[model samples]
Target chain A: MHDSAQDDVTTMTFEAFADTILPGEKRFPGDVTVAGVAVGGGAVASGAVAVLRTDEGGMAPALDNLAEALNGHAGGYAAERGLSLDPAVPPFVALSFADRTELVARLTAPTHPERDIWVSVAMFSTIAFDAAAHLHTVDALADGHPGMTTMGFKPPEADGLWRFPEFSYGRQLARPHPDTTPSGSPA
Target chain B: MTAIESTDVVVVGSGFGGAITAYHLAAGGARVVVLERGPWLTGQDFDQDFKFGSSSTRAFDFTIGDGMSVLAGNCVGGGSVVYFAAMPRAPRFVFERHGSIGRRMWPAAISRDTLEPWYDRVAEALPVTRQDWSDVPYAGGLWAAACHHAGRTANPVPVAIDNERCVNCNWMMSGCRFDAKRSLLLNYLPAAIAHGARIRPLHEAQRLERSDDGGYRLHYTVVDDVDYRVEVGGGAIDAKVVVLAAGAGATPVILQRSADTLGPMPAAVGRYFSGNGERLNTAVIDEDRVREVLGLSRSDGVPYEAYQIGKGPCVATWDRLDGSLPEYLRYSLEQLYFPPGFGTILAQVPDATGPTWFGAEKKELLRHWKSWLTIFTMSEDDNEGVFGPPPPTGNAVRVSQQMLGRGALRYRPTENTLRGWAASDAEVRDILERDGLARVMPWTNDVVGAYTVHPLASCRIGDDPATSALDDRHELRGHPGIFVTDGSAVPGALTVNPAMTIAALAERAVPAIVEAARQRGVAVRYGAPAPDGATAARDAVLPLVAGRAGR
Candidate 1:
């Protein structure tokens, strides 16, 4: 885990986070393999609980990390940043922020490609969800920090989230949901 | 177990204004509840296919903007979801109106200085860019030509989109065929949602009632569009503040409902209304120039293929002739509007009625696609015909709106508009002739027609309560915690797209609202104080390009 101020996420044991935060009970599926987690039926999710089920074995650690992440988000200052694929908030998970982002490093490493990517993506999505409920708008983090644009870093994508069809293209262009056309182009 | 409802700000009509306001307010730590009357559409749902466009039908939702009344979007992303995505700043005269909101306009609204930061913020976010100087029927070149012909440099239009994805599909108004336009649906709204704001779509704000504790009450309905599987039912929301950003037409309507509950609108509430009457004129170029310049090939052009014009097609052709537009006026310009290079082989087929004339046009004898350039003209509407004194017998309540505090006062059109000063017809005609293009038929008569979908001034901002409705800052004169920041607050029209102006103004107004809320002793929850040093430096030192004078 990074420093408390840097990243509040703790390395939780996956089982605990799922058992406590995610409601439905299930075992890690014994099928499918990636870096190496069976994909079949071990994970269980219905609504908000699904987010909890993303990280399988590290369940408790995931919960602790998510909790610490939530604690870091004081109010609506930042949103839960996560990958573009997470589900909408279902009002549970006790989140304060709304921002989301999918951190690819956690659930699936580049070396471990899995056929059922949803499983891993889903796991990371919960991290973002839990984070979002706790975080503020990214601007909150941006405060006092050097603006990326001024520092020659490219501006953030226009739309932070992916609109359904072009969600895959989010990082490629300025907010895939919004087209790159100057106004007056047809939808 | 009763319905849990609260609000820092209650934004009505989630179009450009509402969506933006909600997002910013929520981002700023205010509990914002956005009320949108239309169903939400995501890119996946609104496939960028012509077949989808042909199959899907949309409805008319209107909004008022600087000096004009225009169509508005109603989805969660607000107007950006369905906007043309152009971000031209409001014309100079628009910012300095003489009568209502001009001199007395809110101090924060527009100043080379005040708008500097905001414009930078919005422009960067939308990537509002200059026209591809090379595109045929080139709007940039044409404007330059017209300006040279008129003594004004061509006013380059600032667009709020990623130009790379502009498929030149000619379906801008139909919706981005490609998700290229950086509309709020794809930008601000998502960010706001990410920032904790709650958006309730398909929720039409029917009334604004006052709760027993004097908090605000909003009653809205969840409507269902039978065509779409979307269901909407937003019960009632009680909030601390109410922001009316329903654009031009609907702002007055929402206030009308408030009038029933809050009392007679402040003296200037719904007084001055204007529709920046926008009319289009054009020159049909030799099919070759249209294709070559626009980078489109006519032969390979799809039948009935559309072309791109500046601030291209958002409004319908206005012929004011008491009948449908004559054919030459309707399709001629549309056919010739695209430049020559895109799919050039098909675009310049030379036969208006060729077998390849696309879709049903083949059977209908439609003049196939050609390339042309258009001159879009926006003029002020009649104030008397539009803006009038508040009616005597409307539902009058007791607003106690006694010009209570210092805010925007007057609600009148800008000086230039009031004087009916616009680019001369002779100048326009001269530009047409100089360009070697002729106004083909019926359109010739329609050039003089005053029409537009962008409406403005239904509620002009001013400082004195007696003379205007709200003060310049758009804070309604008497209504505590009530503000109007969207198009409804703009007094006049600009030569460019108004959405950007509205969004930028909203950006400026946001901090003021936040500060004011704090001053009024309202509880603010911005989470732990944004750390002391580095992060604060970043936020404080934003992209501030100070003086971007309007051309």
Candidate 2:
């Protein structure tokens, strides 16, 4: 009955931990230009807000999805980028605006407090959210909070993989390349 | 207005030690009152994934060891409610060694037999069991693999967890989502309440004073929705006894504050604090090897690996605090990592002062990670103070922690220690690289002082009242009736977790306390009639998972 065998991330139905710990929040006006589409590797840019939804509350395991989306199902993304990240960790992606070109950074050394621990910044991105739902309530400070009163928890580094055409990308958050990939399924 | 009430025994601090103590006394017929600073967290209240506390308030903003930002649960359950829930006992020989260090009775005089039963009592209550390996045999592979590689498996630890309730919260540090970890929330505190112990959470104790005839006048505050503190003026509770189970850090502060009535300044108290000679060292297991030892479903999010070194199953030792790991064991791990799993092995050095402290400077800490097969080792230090670290330079002395890696005790090293860690840096580097983990500085293998899990000997017990804080039975000599049943009474270091010992001592002192009160002519009848044997209707207990699980 114990999922102790699974990674720390898999033990939950919807990932509420990373959501809370690293913490991410975003709010948009309901009237903002909204478009929803699937997300792929690369970056996800949307004026309206959007969210990722996996088929199940459990979602496809983080690594599997990361591998599919970040490197493309058959390792296409890595092949294209010619990057050398270990496959040991599933390909995970990060949620970012088009111009924030910096690839998120992560701590990989063991001496660090969380050396072997795995976290998929990219994968957590494509989950379900209600941009429309957010508009229903206001954080009063959205207009007055000093700094990032909200954030879509960009990955500190690429820890997992993504599922192509599997992402929900739109201004209301948009569906990115995944939906637009040549084949109906992200190719 | 002050709400005053009295009881046969008053327990302060809702940690495992105090909770257990209260539970025993209440069940034994004494009416008990328990005070905690945190709220009750039940399964339903567990829904907060990131904000740990149902309310986003942090555990404790108070400063503890060396300006470190401390966090102890303010919830009804206390420390156990927030700990990783490991219940190892002090080694049998730990208390038998006061003479070796030029001190008498380091293992304060107490019967092991009296505490033996409680150990089992506690284990059963938690329904604590070993982690099940069938489904994810390799998940918690790290510890097991390391043990085998180290040849330390014969004494693997027995965790106080209900495996059935465990889930992949992957955030044990934040707190367990599954109730499997028998933290105070699920065990002691509940049983105490069942035995008629009343716990008032969010009642932050700010000051304490002994009333003339005895008992206590506690000044506490109440926190409401608006985060406003409502002062409940000091009120006197004419109880016959009070047990201070507040943690090592806070316990000393209490004694230090009431130095006059509490008794003479003991050369102990907060002295010789060790984070269990606790260390964070890594054993190299490649990516694939990591999988072999610790089974991880890449998709699952984290390795379900359960790994640990040092004491367990029965006793804890200053076993860690240093990496004098035998050579053969090291070879065994290297041998185990036959096939490559992860590229390099990882060893995370957790600190009692991580982030949030030291300006929470992540930038500086990140730089220390370069080329190191990292791990932190906390060792037991014998030289402690009666009063605490000297002031003026207390700040500067705190920063000297960097010197711990090579700081040696004045005398001989413990039976299984490096005589001089300062000379082993090259050896460690060679040993690790030869074994395929990482290359690091020369003193990596030296004798670093242990950070300790807060073991203490303040108000330590002794025969002579003039020299120590408390006498043979944990009673402050001056007050005669006042007692310290928590870690505040230990006379020496414990090579294992002190909870079991603390509980045992506290339980042992009760009989004596009652006897004294009787001798003093106080009517000590066991409290109100017990309802049918079933535990009293539960207190506002909280579960690990919000609503998903039942208490």
Best by DockQ: 2
lDDT for each of the candidates? 0.42, 0.37
lDDT of 1 by residue, B374-409 (tens): 445554433321433222211111111110011111
- Chain A only: list TM-scores of all candidates: 0.20, 0.23
The number of the candidate with the highest lDDT is 1
lDDT of 2 by residue, A32-65 (tens): 1111111211111210112122211122334333
iRMS of each prediction in angstroms?
Answer: 23.1, 22.1
Model 2 chain B: ten consecutive residues of lowest lDDT: B334-343
CAPRI class assigned to model 1: incorrect
Tell me how each candidate scores on DockQ against the true complex: 0.01, 0.02
Q: Weakest 10 consecutive residues, lDDT, candidate 1 chain B?
A: B398-407
